[model samples]
Target chain A: MRIAVVVFPGSNCDHDAYHAFKHVLGVETVFVWHKEADLRGADAVVLPGGFSYGDYLRAGAIASRSPVMDEVSRFAGKGGPVIGICNGFQILCEAGLLPGALMRNRGLRFICRDVFLRCETSGTAFTSRLSNGDVIRLHVAHGEGNYFATPETIVRLEAEQRIVFRYCDPTGRLDPEWNFNGSLEAIAGVLNEGRNVLGMMPHPERMAEAILGGTDGIAVLGSLLDYLESLPLKGGKRGEVAREAAGAAQKGAEGTKGASGREAGGRCKAV
Target chain B: MEETMKAKVTVSPRRGVRDPQGRAVLGSLHALGFPEVVDVRVGRFIELIIEPKGEGGPDEVEARRRQEQRLDEMCRRLLANTLIEDYRFETEP
Candidate 1:
């Protein structure tokens, strides 16, 4: 499969992602600069982790406005698969491709360590290879990875099964300490309404090989490839209905907040 | 008569950082008998005042604009991270 990894100023993980795809997955990969507007015949795109724009303003805020993001948005709109890791996830949120926003760690500390993530939904192309509740270990390194969203949005995401992963223990038990950044509901990742776009705080690329302690991440990447291979040669009609539904849900939640004195719940669960 | 120009710039996390200061403040508030504090984040404020360079001349506006622009740039490049910090400025004469 052809893959494109977008590179922006201060993006340090682009090369790492390239290696994962090129060496481990044996896929044809290309580096697309953030200024480039074209995907150059790529079937899927990966926004690698790193401190884009030096994590200035917000981890992914500046990079979201980069020129290449227009193309990325269009590609996602066309139903192309996109996976954003770490800061890339931040950018996706900043670009509005994903719901919610990444906030500072609740502990006000930068966390860098191996984290456990429980698979929430295996129905999507990103997690089809894994079983629901499957636990995978990956590295999470960031200061601002906490995810926040209004209550209605969280409810809709849960109802739609859009949440993909949650911070948990190796035994797949929800543990607060396993939550690296205190993400709402201990969410480590989520999928867009289309389910083709994914944003996660953990770095799967860092654990794609056995040498990295385990090969759990390979399954996640493999799932993407499997899904891409299953797609019809011609791109399918984009899914706008899901987006509309999500927007409506957000509005409903906002309206509820306006009328009631209740605060929004955590994206996953209240800690 | 001379006119003075003033500008106020406020800088904050593009996404508010988990603020230990705010948390501490919240803890103190809780100790003082308030427990509804959910989260807290801190931000900064900066203000600058300058004399009008010239009466409505391009040079004056350009220079002032450049100065303000420079300050904004400095906030992102040095004072704040373009990624996690945002800044806004207001000007008055």
Candidate 2:
């Protein structure tokens, strides 16, 4: 299947994503410029990592408003699968496609290291290949990867099982020290309400090839292909079934609805 | 009317949010024997020189209204991340 790698003005990982999907996975891939208004009909989309617009004002804040984001939002509104890594995750949150925000790292340092991520759920299209609680090692490189959201939103995400991954030790034990960033609930990755979009701080493409370092990322990429293959052609009886699955994944997003209604007290911040 | 205005925008992390830089400074102070320092929060400020929008100097009330509106838009859309930060602005003509 064809995959689209969106290249923002300052995105540096476009080539890496292209290599992972085109060489490792043997899939057709194209580099879609951030200025482009459409996806050109790709089966899947990947928002690669980088300092878009030099991360001026705030990380991912500027890039999220690029013209391409309009179509990206529409594509996500459908059942198309989307994966955002590192800075891409920040963009997703800024675009309102994902909940919460990425704050400064708790240690106030730009951390770059391999960390273990335990798959919290396999219910979404992004993690269907892995069983729950499976651990994968991925590289994380960023200064503002600490995720924060209201307590109510965290509870909703937990109840919906949308937290696809959490920081943990190799043996699958979640320890505070193991959390590279002070993300709430030690969240390493999360799925949107529809479960088709995933935002994670780790760079899976960096670990997708054995030559690079590891092959753990294969599972994550492989699962996307599997999920894509499982869906039938658009506008058919089989398509109806796939749509139903997507519908079930759109759990209630309380924060998105009550941003102004909720009092700002007690909401956790990174300090 | 044309008028030159200086606007100062202050952006700070919302309360209950983590401020690693602020915490680091606080630690440094404590280590330097400034134990009385209770708390410290780090933030950023931006100075903007707003150019005249029209031919002559605008009326005082109109200039203040325009400056405030522009500053709010700038903060909301670019200068600050509303999700995690709050911003306040003051202008002088």
Candidate 3:
């Protein structure tokens, strides 16, 4: 399962994403430059975090109009799984691939810290490994992480079961105090209508390894790997092929654009 | 003949959308002796100078119309994100 991580100018987390997928998780990952128009036969695409175009106009705004985005949009259109992390999420929203817009944080501060998030749904590839009500911890750092949508869109998001994660206390109780960014509904992540595109203000790549203080990211990223490996014709081998392909992918890393996945946040519940 | 038109575009959060930045500015305003300021809305201001292509006098009216139309299109396509903000612009020769 070859994955393409698109990089735009000023993206800072591209290497982190590359390490998580290629080195830690042993997945075949590639770096796709933002100036390029193709995904190069990659199965899924990742829009990593960072200040693309220096977050000009708006976070992820300029990068959304990059050449690679058209290809990413087309890929998502064909049912390929796409994940936008942090600024990546902002890009997805700006590109109209996902609903809602991320505005300045409620308190008007650039918050950087570890937060808890409760799994709101188990239907998406990003959260399939986790169960409803499960809580995971990831890092979040941004000045504009507050998520907003029109009332109608918010209602639709709830009715359609597209919300993937929400902030909560350690015991999984929802509360306003825990909604650090003041995101509407205390939302931390959401899925598109197709259930293929996921945009979250948190960085899962930053926490994929246990040495980094936790392995909760496995439930998210690993679930994606699980989904990919389970594919009959599209995905092949877990025993040996995955390892060799991953090694080859690391060697081919020089060929594209990149950005980092911003820190992630998840609400906590009773384990 | 070549003529230049000056334009200004304004983009702001729609009513009912939260305005944390505006609120922050309002708080500061109130602190600075502007108690009468009960409401504040932060917005972006952009200026543009347009040089309409094609010959000028014969198609002046048509050129102006197309210039305005393109300005509107630019706002819709890039300058403003209608999902959350409202945008309007005016041009002058």
Candidate 4:
């Protein structure tokens, strides 16, 4: 599938993300500068992690308002799939495309290391290839990976099955040490209301190859390709899906609908 | 007559980085027996003094406004890391 990786000043991972899709996944990938307002026919978009705008004024804050974000928002509004990793995740939170905010590490330090993530859902296009409760290894490098939300928002997220991934131990158990940045409820990642948009702290592109010590990230990227391939050859436009998803998300939030399968507030309860 | 002009600026986190200072301050407040502390993030407070120019001397209000604009440029270009900080300015005459 064709993909676009957004590039902003100080975004160091854009290249890696582009190469992973181009060389590893053997797909056409484009680098869209932050100043650009168009997606250029990309089927999906990835916001690579890095110290965007030098991590000034709160990571992702300045970058969130960059010109390209307006396009990203519009693209997602039309149902195009978008993924934000590391600092990109910070930008997404800053842009309000996803719920909750990312806070500083509970340890008060920048963390750069590999961590284990437990997949919490498999129903969406992002994780349709993986089974629920599957464990994957990926790299996380950030100081403010901790996620926070009001108690009510947390409950709503869980009830909606929006909590997609959580920090976990090697054996798939939730542990404090594995909870790298002390995210609220061990949250490592989450999905926007319609599940087409994903924001996660870990770098899946960094783990797409076995030579990189693992290939678990392949499934994540592969899932996108899987969805793209599943689309009908004719009369299947992406913009329609994104718009529908955006509408559904607004409705979901307005309705205060409960999560599909999980218990209320259970996903983010302190462990 | 003496005229005085001053500008005050503050810089803070944009929205994403975990504000450890804010959280720590909250924790400290709780430890200090103040349970009302919920959120806190450390930021910078800067004060600048501007002297009037010319025979009539600097217009306090005008000088303060000019200095405030300059301070904003400084924050966006240097003083504050825009990626992680947000800033504001106040002027006094």
Candidate 5:
């Protein structure tokens, strides 16, 4: 299937995503310029990370208004898979495609390093390849990656099980010190209410291969492909796949013998 | 009359949200022996001059009202993200 990588003026990870999808994953990939109105027939959309528009007026605020985002919004509305990594996550939130916001890191430093995450939900398009409570390592680099929302919004996110990932120790313990940016509730990523849009601080494209020091991220991308392939031949209607996936995830959570292991927290070295 | 309306906007992190930059500044102040400082919230200041669209037809009062409305819209749309920050503006008479 073809994937479209949306490129804003200052996007630095566009090529990394391109390489991962085109060469590593063997998926047809194309770059859609910020000025382009159409997505050029992409089945899925990835907004790669960078200080788009110099992070002017706040990170991702300006790029969120780019001409191409109009098309991205249209694509997302139809229940298409959209993954926004790092600054792209900021854009998604600013554009109202996702909830909450990414604020300055609590430590006031630009963090660039590896962190572990536990899969909180498997129903979303980006997490179908993972089991609930599976832990993986990914790299995050940003100055404004702290996630914040109203207490009520956080509660709603929890209740809906839209939290796709959360920061954790390598052994899968949910401790405050492992939260790289101090995101609220240790949230490392979240799915939109519709479950099609994913916004996360970590860069999966950066860790798609074993040579890059890890292959954990491929689980996320592979999950999207698997979800797309599993849909009815017609692709069904909006929310069809999401609904089925949620049911499957719920079943998986209930039937797995390892459910208690998840609660105990340690599975293995995350990466 | 394509008069230019001037405005000043201030944007800051909402209360109770962590302001790391402001906290860093606060730390520096404390190190400089300013224990009196108990809190800090870093923010942004922006100045905008809006020119009316092409020989506007509105009267002076109406034009000013429209300008104020546009300024508010600007703040809501771009100048501030109401989710994590708050914004206020002052316009020239």
Candidate 6:
């Protein structure tokens, strides 16, 4: 299937995403300029990482209002699979396509390193390849990756099981030290309520190849193909796939309701 | 007669949210022996001039009302991320 990588003016990771999708994953990929109105017949869309618009007003504020976002929003409304990485995640939050906001890091430092992420819930278009509670390593680099949301929104997100990934240690421990950006509950990635859109701080494309340090990210990237293959060969009308996925996620959350009595539980109640 | 209206907007992090930069500044102040400064917060200040849309401006009351509304919209839509930031504006007569 063909994938479209949206390129903003200051987007630095566009090429990395292109290389991973085209060279590594062997998927037909094309670059769609920020000003382009149409998505150029892409089955999936990726908003790659970068300081779009120089991150002037805010990390993703200016880039969110660019001309092409209008199309992206429409594409998302149709329940299309869209992945926003790093600054792209910030842009999605700014554009109102996702819940919560990526505030400045709690330590106020630009953190750039490899971090471990636990697959919080499975069946998502982005993480369908992995089983629940799997740990994967990916590189995260950002100054404003601290994810924050209102207490009510957090509750809703948890109840819906939209939290796709959480920071963790190699042994899958959810301690504060593993949280690279101090995101609430160590949230590294999240899915929109519709379950089709995903926004995350870590760069999966960066880790898609073994030469680049790790190939663990391919599970996240390759899930797109797996998801598309599972859907009926209709013209991108896979709303049922998303619904079934969300149903599984909700069940997973219900199954683990009383099991996780850790810091995340305390923080949730404290809110 | 035409008049140019000016506005000053101040944007700051929402209370109860962690402000690392502000905390760093507070630490520096404490190190400098300024114990009197119990709290420190960082914010942004922006100023802009706005002209009425049509050839001539509306009456003073209507002009101020329109300007205020536009400024609020600007802050909500672009200038500030209301989720994590609070914004206030002052319009000059």
Give the CAPRI class of candidate 4. incorrect
Residues B1-93 of candidate 3 have per-residue lDDT tens digits of 276779999999888888998899999999999999998999899999877676656876787788788999999888988887899998777
Candidate lDDT scores, in order, read 0.76, 0.81, 0.81, 0.78, 0.83, 0.83
The best candidate by DockQ is 6
Model 4 stretches with alpha carbons more than 4 Å out: A236-271, B1-19, B22-41, B46-89
Deviation of model 2 at A264, angstroms: 36
Score chain B of candidate 5 by TM-score.
0.84
| Residue-by-residue lDDT tens digits, candidate 3, A1-271 | 7888999998887888888999999988999999999888887789998999998888998999999999888777655678999999999999999999999999999998888999987735677688999989998889998999988988878876778999888778899998999999999999876566899998899898888878787788887777566444424443233333322322332122101110011111111
lDDT accuracy of residue A32 in candidate 2? 94
Better of 3 and 5 by DockQ: 5
- Best-fitting candidate, scored by lDDT: 6
Summarize candidate 4's per-residue lDDT along A84-202 as a digit string, tens digits: 99899999988889887787888888998889999987756677667778999998889988898767878877877788899999988999988978898999888887566899999
Runs of candidate 5 exceeding 4 Å displacement: A235-271, B54-58
Pairs that collide, model 6? none
Count steric clashes of candidate 5: 0
For each candidate in turn, give its C-alpha RMSD to the true structure in angstroms.
Answer: 8.7, 6.7, 8.5, 7.6, 6.1, 6.0
Q: What would the per-residue lDDT of candidate 1 be over residues A99-208, giving only the tens digit for each residue? A: 98887788877888898999998746677678888899888888888888767888978876788999998899998877767788998899886566899999989888
TM-score of each: 0.73, 0.87, 0.88, 0.75, 0.89, 0.89
Candidate 6: clashing residue pairs, number? 0
Error of 5 at B15 (Å): 1.7
**Candidate No. with top TM-score:** 6
Q: After superposition, how far is residue A234 of candidate 4 from its true place, in Å?
A: 2.8
Error of 1 at A197 (Å): 0.8
For each candidate, the DockQ is 0.17, 0.72, 0.79, 0.21, 0.83, 0.89
Q: Candidate 1: how close is chain B to the reference, as a TM-score?
A: 0.62
